[model samples]
Target: MNKRLLWLLFSILFMAGCSVLSSTDPEFSRENYDSWYDKGEYQKALNHVNERLETYPEDALLWNEKGYILISMEQYNEALQPLEKAIELNAELDSAYNNKALAYNETGEYEQAIVAAQKAIDLSEEEPEQFINMGNALSFLERDEKALEYFNKALAIDANAPYAQYGKGVSLYFLGKYEEGIPYFENYLHSYPNDIDALWYLVYSYDTLGDYMETIPYLNQIIDNQKENPINTVDYKGLMLTYAGELEEATTIYDGIIEQYPNEAIGYYGKGVLQIQQGQTDNGLQSLEQAVALDNSLKETAYNDPLLSSVYNDELFKRIVE
Candidate 1:
């Protein structure tokens, strides 16, 4: 799975409609605040909250709302002040604790996140979201077994919670229970059909399990969605295609990559390995030599690649790789 995608998903649950605009803001009503937030105008919403707090400095809800807006803007560090202030004003404000946990998690303060999330859960045990948040925090600390336990706890409270499903799937996958992880992700996709993070991991789990055929459709989806960053997926798709026995298609992909980036040794190395595996020894050896000449570091990888095994005993192959 994509590491960026996991980081993004881990801290995403807290921003789901946690706005708390006051009905009594005569100068800036809740309707106006809601409109700005609903239309993705987080900056405007943040400004409105700041303006409101100028008059009502004691409003815990406004503090929470400001923190939520800052979070939407990806300003996790800026979000903490208002969130802590919210908790300071109202000690029982579970949402404030939950949002603080999210901010802390995003900033790589996993220990703080765990403490805040547990506080939120203590205040509102019935709220499944706090459990999910706590699980995500634990997962970030590489305590996946503990994360799975909290995820299951959240699922018991709200069986259809999408984040809980996603967290459970991630924890299970990391724990080497790939088959068990599949249903959790599949169930989440039923509700969130276009979740690329989940789809990417589904592809990864299947690929790791040697179910190359099962990974094809999701791989195609990722490839199509990644057109703007073709470099990220092109070589990976080539390797996956090779694994699935679509050698001709894989070679075509390598050819396109080599043409697009002639100086890059990876394209040549991949092409050489695939060619050698396909019985084109002479052409493959030449390609490998060019690859090694361009980037000598590739010699170590080329030496170990199983695709070059056919020529393992051949002195010509040994010399080029060495």
Candidate 2:
């Protein structure tokens, strides 16, 4: 009887010890999962989370962390399950809701994202980042006016909010208030000189306002910063050819581009403009025809092209535009 009792006691003690060890373990599974996440091995991180969930099913923080990892991977649909579970476990987990909204936004579910973002904003109180995120969600929903309001709110909370200022500029640009947009873009550039999107918008705004001269310096800066960025070089060349009146230099650059990218429509279009500017009618018409055949998208601007304006009444020009 004593032998049996001793064995039973040993078994009970062993089981108790195992339970304590498991409970006191530093969540090594979560640590491994995070390591995978930091390495950009998102699928591996998610698999680790699933394994941990089997052992710690009631861990709300683990579920929310998993949701954040899934959102980073752009696995938006898959992210919803864990995030919803997190919200169910702890209604006050603001980051879970914020991550859920990000996932919704990634999946193009803008309305749902807006609802989720609003919840996050309520939880965040006066946080500027939350307001900026809310503005982004509103922008995706085509509620530009409301988006601008949120952007302004974000700026009020944090005057140097880059995302908010950039959002405001984009909204204003879409609303056709280019003049209002320009200052915001300029402000963003003052702090973020390497912002390619802002630089592109600044160039576009100046071009639209017939202040092409002002755009040249920024384009030059972009080219200097990014040596291999072909788009900036091409845009700069086109703008210089149009407004700078350096036909000979423009011709040389366009010819080089055409030789490098024979099938590219922009190079042909550029060359055609250069030819027309030099009074080479037949060559210009041929180059323009090649450009149109390569990509008909250039047709809209062909008529309004300053170089082609001189030949507006020409029969060949009419045929090409038609």
Candidate 3:
């Protein structure tokens, strides 16, 4: 699935505080199950649901709950079974259809996701989730204009809908209306100030407009977040700095990356590009040679980039890329 969907799932699972769902039996309580689910105890929640299902075998709600928990755990394939069962047991379960759409979307079954979301919308036109789901499916299918329409429909129903706001921004960005997409991402960031997804779009939109300086704050936010979780390897901050003509700051970032990850070729590549752009042809060529030696895959990129044109016909540059 796309990063948009992943961000939505994380927001739902973490931000939607433990609200208890209605249960048929007093014995099959939500208290214990909700506590487990809220604490990221998927296995415990699954066990509880399995035990309850034995006594309440026909409970469509229980099956749906199980499916929802499974989706939260990212067990999309496993989630389908319970969600499908919930629909079979009670065809009118609109929420079950929505959950099913979520599972299908996660698995890249966009057509099935659209069908399930349409079913949910048919069952309950008042809910914004169905529209958001449909929009997300359309976005993934590259029907960005159609996706924007659904997102607008959801926004008409609830102006403050975070998913709708985020969807509108994403759809507009995908449609190449990057300038128009900025406000929607800003609105989303108002609700979720530190959300990496919204910040990423802000960075991208500004960068696309050739206003790389405008991307700094958002890039800093992402850089700060990466400190908390370092799996992110992309040097967006450095790239933005280079684009904005902040060569010193960009070089510092590249230097840090090389110090931290000595063998990674991208750091050297970025440093080389920056150096060449700043007219240090000899030093840049040396760095580029080191980068190519580490990873020859970047040779084509280095050869074609306009910023390196000054040395395009240079003997050393030709040797490095060729």
Candidate 4:
């Protein structure tokens, strides 16, 4: 062959090789989706997995990955079929069943989640997550004692498992053993300090045990962290004044709560009561107005609260709460 013709042939071969090595190509053999998935960039991961699935539709691992991603996205109903298909393709794939359990759990199908989690436990290579899934399902079904067994099993497998600790704590909590639940909750919180759910669980447990002072700090943390908190901060203020008698500390906590969650009425309501107790009459009244402006329900609260008796007839207070 002529030199020019040989060079053109080499260029064509190299271009074809590079084309075949792209990430989407089934023959390319890269774990590209893992990076996206691990980084919590699910959409990018899904797109990448979908590209591979287009070429290798029967791949069990890819289908399982797809199902898990959908679950993580909270599309539980959508995740089911892919997970089922993964199981169909590879009956022994324990992780697929585990993923299915999580999806079913989210959909409130506790019985089905238990069934899938059991299969995962049977097939998994002693994975603590499998037991934790089983425990969560049982707990959701209100069978906390039975859930405790599974959570303990998970703990047996991995002593430092955060999910297992949380599960054990929740089971103990539902069983009315608040004191026993405390340590496990603390253990879980050690791993996930910002988890609102765990923090709330700890607060409720402390409140039930009459550990009013202990509840205050967690309540403050929840108010600062939770965007749509369901907790009644006004009631928390009452607990602070009535049970804790740490008015100064409570006032400072409420101040931080107000600063951290400026738009929430509860924080302002809490701070208002604290200010009134300290005899900052004008500041207290202003806080009350702000509270009622944010949530009209606080008006009724302010009017009924004993702590506001002296201010009940104050014109600004009457206009604010009444």
Best by lDDT: 1
For residues 196-289, what per-residue lDDT tens digits would candidate 4 score against the true structure?
Answer: 6777777777777877878867876777776765356545744555456688766766776777778988888887877887789899898888
lDDT of 2 by residue, 1-322 (tens): 1211111111100000000112222464555755775687877777776777788887766787687776767666988998899789777666677777667766777688788878877776566665666676777666878988988997898787676778788777767788898888788777778766677677777777778767776776676677574753664656565676767767777877788888888888888877888889889988998999999978877988766889899899898888
Q: Give candidate 1's TM-score.
A: 0.88
Model 1 lDDT, full chain set: 0.82
TM-scores for all candidates: the values are 0.88, 0.74, 0.84, 0.70
lDDT of 1 by residue, 66-122 (tens): 887898788999999999998898887888898888888888888998999898888
For all predictions, the C-alpha RMSD in Å is: 2.8, 14.9, 3.7, 14.5
Arrange candidates by lDDT, highest first: which order? 1, 3, 4, 2
Off by over 4 Å in 3: 1-23, 27-36, 227-234
Per-residue lDDT of model 3, residues 190-219, tens digit only: 988888878888887898899988998887
Per-candidate total of colliding backbone pairs: 0, 0, 0, 0
Top-TM-score structure, candidate number:
1
Q: Where does candidate 2 stray beyond 4 Å?
A: 1-55, 186-196, 216-236, 244-249, 289-306, 319-322
Candidate 4 stretches greater than 4 Å from native: 1-31, 228-238, 248-322
Locate the minimum summed-lDDT window of 10 residues in model 1. Answer: 16-25
> What TM-score does candidate 3 reach?
0.84
lDDT of 1 at 114: 95
Clashing pairs in 3: none
Task: Order candidates by TM-score, high to low.
Answer: 1, 3, 2, 4
For lDDT, candidate 1 versus 3, the one ahead is: 1
